[model samples]
Target: MSNVYIDQFPAEAKVIRAAFYSSFLALALGGVFGIIQTLHRTDFLRFMDSVDYYTVLTAHGVFLVISFTIFFLVGIFTWAVTTSLDRGLEDIRFTWGWYSLMAIGITMTGVAILAGFTDAIDMSASVLFTFYAPLQAHPLFYLGLVLFVVGTWVAGVDWFRSWWAWKAENPDERIPLPTFMVLTTMLMWYIATLGVAAAILLFLLPWSLGLIETVNPLLTRTLFWFFGHPVVYFWLMPAYMMWYVMLPKFSGGKLFSDPLARVVFVLFLILSVPTGIHHQYLDPGIAEGFKFIAMTNTMFLLLPSLLTAFTVVASMEHGARQRGGEGYFGWLKALPWRDPVFTGMALAGLMFAAAGFSGMINAGMNINYLVHNTFWVVGHFHLTVGTAVALTFMAVTYWFLPQVTGKALWSRSVALGQVVVWFVGMTFMSNAMHRAGLLGVPRRTAEPQYEGFEFQAAVGSIGELDAQIALGGVLLTISLGMFFANVVGTALNGRSDDLPANEYAGALSGPDDAPLVLDNLKLWTAIAVVLVIFAYTFPLLSIIDRGGLFGPEVIPFPLTVESATTLGFALETAASTSFESAGEIATSALTAVMR
Candidate 1:
């Protein structure tokens, strides 16, 4: 029998393959919108008026971040849990149930967003991914997100239960490293999602349905970001999983430090949630002390990624050395450069190193003034989430697809070419975006240039920068095409009777070298929750005390001047109602005195 995943565990392989396909569908959709956006914004092309830009932007963010990312996570985490435990899922029916629920949620949310382009639908939600409240989206949008979040929660539970079952059979063995990573990440996920749950269920959903008249913008924003920052970590940890478990093996060596890897995940679980306030440093309503705490935590959070860089690089170096390579950096040339999996992941990590410096500037409370909401911010995240997570996922597909299908790779050369194209394309686009941002280019705008100011570059004209951006987008779009073609072709034609068995590289240092405390997930979960309460309690209270949960409401700003001016006029009137009420009472008292 073939030692591939499909031969060893066919049912689990099917589930994983299904989830991956769903994720790829989202990627394809997101890529279409991504190209359209880059072209339209750069004035390279225009298929729709500027009014529709927000709609497209909303789709791109939601589809890629929520759908593409989480679905891949579900698949990969499922694979990790199953492969590490050496067991099939406890119940195939329950497994399929969660997948179905996720599909429905994504469909519902996507429909609500796509509706924005048409006048035919009475419902539309162009509110963008932040979904900043007081800027209402259709109720279905929130409803859809609610289902999605719940589905993921259940999926996490499924993993936990599987782990529990494994323990009963081998009660003395420490939890496997891959299984430990999944459990800890899921624990953090449950803690992180509470903020968004409260935001949608209690606030945005009701307000959108007209059950409530107004919402506190600060509170909603705080809640959104409470979920937001931690969510970034959630996206990243799976990519980290591949780095720790899969990458060294692909490089032809073992993982360097098992114990340090556990510590890195534990640090993320504790640090990720408490640091959300750094995102709000520029907003006036929040106090500075809170911002300082968040900034401190944010800086501390950098330790793990730095540790990761050192560990991953060291592990790869070991691989090269094992292959009879020598010297400080000369061993880098001995790596499996032709392997798409290794190259894609290595380049993604390289981009992440660049992203880290920019992210530090964003996290620093004082320095935030320089890059907040600028293309610099966008560029920073694209390098991290866009490349680090995304490229890693794409690269993983190159290795993982074959395991489930019992297939030889379609063309190693084609896969290598695709990853290189992605790296080169993103370098052009992200570098231009970073430079444009330093020049104060506002992001999320249909047209970046304004008549009042001319954007002069140190090295080139603004027009030239736009050309670079457009060219990069074109290249990225082409890369996506090549990737899709390779994957689809492999899926169809990649069967081989001689496929190798599924395996991860063993660590040079084993889990026995690590302290047992690392496996104490219950204790870690408790600490994570405590940190979250400490981080959010006062900030949330201040928002609610200054404004009630529902009111002392502020009108949402119109996205465009051409939007209903009448709505703004009405908001101005309603906002002055308290003053009018006080004046009416004073006038009545004065009239009585005269009498």
Candidate 2:
């Protein structure tokens, strides 16, 4: 009999399959919107009105980053907990409950965003992914996000429940590496989410529903970044878990060091939440000192990533050597290049190294000014979450789908081609984006070119960059199609009894080799909470003190063209009056002083 996951835990497998399907659905929706925006922005295709671009952008962002990635990782985490512990969920019903909550929540949020395309629904949420203040969305959007996050919170509880139960039975044993990873990540998430939860529940949600007259935009932004920056790691930790636990096995070697992996996760848990202020380096209201502190925290974050790089690469090398590969660089040939899982993850890691370099530039407050809110930032993230996280998930899906479904993969060749094509497409797209950003091109706009103004490229014409972006978009669309083809084909295939057993790599330096303190979850969580408090308490107080809890008498954003025009005129008039009053005051002060 095959020792696949389905055979071992049929009920849990079903839930995982459901989660994967949901993730794929979101990926499809997001991919469609992704191509639409890419083609429209590059002027290669203009089927939709430019006004609809923000709607498309919002959908693409929410569906992929919020829905797709989270849904998929939840499944992965559940699997990690179950497979590593050799136990089924304590309550299968509870598992289904959380998944259902997530599904319903995202569906509601998705509907609100899609409603932007039509006046028929009398609802719209064109607020992009950041959902920054003044760009208000419907209450349903906020409510739905609440439920989704809450569902994740419940999911975290489920993992903890499993760990606690396992600990009871194996009291003296160290926490399993995968479980340890999931727990640490969840702790970080819990801390990080407090910001967004406060932002939405206390401010954004009520404001959107007309319960509040106004909000401090800077305050809301600060709250968002507190959640925003760490959320990057939330998306990334699962990918890291896969890299640390699964990649070595696929490379034909055991993990190089379990202790190092635990330390990396611990570092991430402690450091991830406090560094979000770096995203707001250019924003007013926050002091430069706080921004500098955020920058310092962000730089410290690089240590965990570097450790990950060293440990994962070392594991891969050990695997290669075990396969009789000799010499330093020559051992690379011994890797299982034919396996989409290994190649995809390896390439993702390589791309992440590039992301790290660009990320440093972003973390540096001075250098960041050049690219803040520019296309370069967009390019940098595409390499990080776009490739590193997305590619790793897709590649691993080849292995995971069969395990869950009891079916053989339809075409390994197509799967391999999909990963390669995605890498190439992103290279073309991200490179052009970075180049354009360097030339002062702005992001989040449907039209980058103006009638009288032209962006002068150092080496190439703007037209060339547009072409590259369009080409990349087309190639990416093709890659997505290939990926879906494999998925559908596998779902249609008959059950196979020859599937590989469900397992992760063993460590050369096992958990026992590590100090007991490494597994002290309470100690690490305490430290993480302390760091977050230190990083955010003063900054939050300063923002509220300067900008009030409700802020100045600021008008809500204008949605209609007429309203926008009126607001513009009003702002211009107000500015003129203020300047005149300031001049009179100065004149009066000078006369009094002279007398």
Candidate 3:
């Protein structure tokens, strides 16, 4: 009855495998640096200074955040889109071009960072990824970034081209759910990357090269955030896609509202990209009114995110009920616990969405001041991005690996242990970070030093948190080691040619249902473009009167503690110049200019 063969596994699977290999390599590199940074933060490792810290940070950011996530998404997007259309990878000519460019760009950027070439752009201590203006990286770093982004863009085009050709071939059919979501996310990433691309190519690169003594750091930061904020959504989109499209089916239920999931994707295209200005709330260059609008829009974004949470929960509930789960809490146990795929996704979704709830607070205007640039912010992101998103990726890999390689998992027990370790470790790590921030511990440093007041009390608490993180990491590392072994082992030893073709689990109707049309993201893309333009207009316009908007550019570069406070008032000078006559105006202006 079935004719598909192991050796005849879909070509898309091969491409995905290659992509996973690349992404896993990057993750490994980044994770190593992440561990080093964590150790350095807790004073477990003190030999690394600022330069070393930044180098590790940059590598982690570029490789892990940029290269690994984007590349993995590209492969997954392509696979989902092609499979849904009942086709293999199309636009084959450009696929290699895209991969080559991305591979080269990632390697070059990593080399530049490790070579200390990033020092060219006032690397002093700026470890911010997306390197918002007011901080800079070398022109090579920016170019590398541009090249990498272009590579991803090329991948997007390939996806659309293939999907479009598929539609033309079969004009009457609807696209598959998984593929539709992939296109939606691709459209979002394409629109979002433009802002950062512009900032890097138009501003940061030139400024780093001395093309302009002052390139208006405010404008640069504004543009970078325009890209930066949405990119987070981009990383999460695939995870979200899997959560909505696959998780329910894995739990053994119909997707409650398939159409609603699409609508939520559409909403993200409208809302997420335009709210970047909220990140600039504390900065003076952006107006309070503009920031307020951004903040309000950010609040609106919670609607779609919450909608997603509800959808996932309801779907899981259906699965639980299907399995004879009755009570509210009983469904939790009724879930397919031994099925690593279902359980992993459900738990990861619940945990990450919990983290996302906290993110709403971080995105708010006034509340941001309480955690701005602090470990609380750090903790919040790790919960969402690191814990939530990363776990989903892991879930996917585990779910699909056997299918891809025609092998059974080498050690299910070990894989389960790994997920538990990662989750427990992250909770401890993030909670400690939140408490540390409340105790006034700053983030993005090699060492956080403190003076007399309750510092010892604070330090004592951190030791327990740090120990938890270390133990968790050890467990996670063991799990990860098992995963690598399982995958490689299955690939080589368990190519069971007689095994059944593993059907991709998802929220599809029964054999009688019509397939979905691969909808064009053109409207969504256009709406996103318009929203981004509107969002950035006021922020960018402020740069027109550079001196007036951001205050006169004064810099020997970094600011002192006293100047930092003065600069705060100076940024508000445009609305009220009373601070200019405070006799402390120069110091304030200097801080404002330097920051």
Residues 1-595 of candidate 1 have per-residue lDDT tens digits of 7678888889888888888999999999999999999999999899889888988999999999999999999999988989999998899889988988898998999999988878788777888889986667788889999998998998998998899999999998988989988988898888889989999988889888778778888898999899899999999999999999999999999999999999999999888898988889988789999999889999999999999999999899999999988998899999989889999999999999999999988988878898898988888888998899999999989888898777777878888888898898889899889888988899999888788889877888788888888888888888899889888888888468876678887999989999999889888888888888888899889988987888675554334434547676876897799789989999999999999
The prediction achieving the highest TM-score against the true structure is 2
Better of 1 and 2 by lDDT: 2
Candidate 3 lDDT tens digits, 1-595 = 3323224435666666777788888888888778778777776766666446766777777777887787778777765776567666665657878888888887767766666524454333233475755655556677777888898888888887877888798786666677777778777877788788877777667767777666666776777888888999898888888888678878887676766677788788778888988888898866798898899889888888889988788888888898899986977888887766676676677677667767877888888898888878777777777767777887777766665565666667766766766777776677777767766677777667655544334346766766655565555555566656656665676555554454454553332243232144676677778877887776777655654433346442322234445666667775466645664778888999999
Q: Give each model's clash number.
A: 0, 0, 5
Would you estimate the TM-scores of all the predictions? 0.94, 0.96, 0.87
The total number of steric clashes, by the backbone 3 Å criterion, in model 3 comes to: 5
Worst 10 residues of 1 by lDDT: 555-564
Per-residue alpha-carbon lDDT of candidate 2 for residues 404-523, written as tens digits (9 for 90 to 100): 999999999999999999999999998898888888888999988899898987799889999998888888899999999999999999999888999999999999999999999999
lDDT order of candidates, top first: 2, 1, 3
Give the alpha-carbon lDDT of every model: 0.89, 0.93, 0.71
Which 10 successive residues of model 2 have the least lDDT summed?
A: 555-564
| Per-prediction CA RMSD (Å) | 5.3, 2.6, 5.9
Off by over 4 Å in 1: 554-595
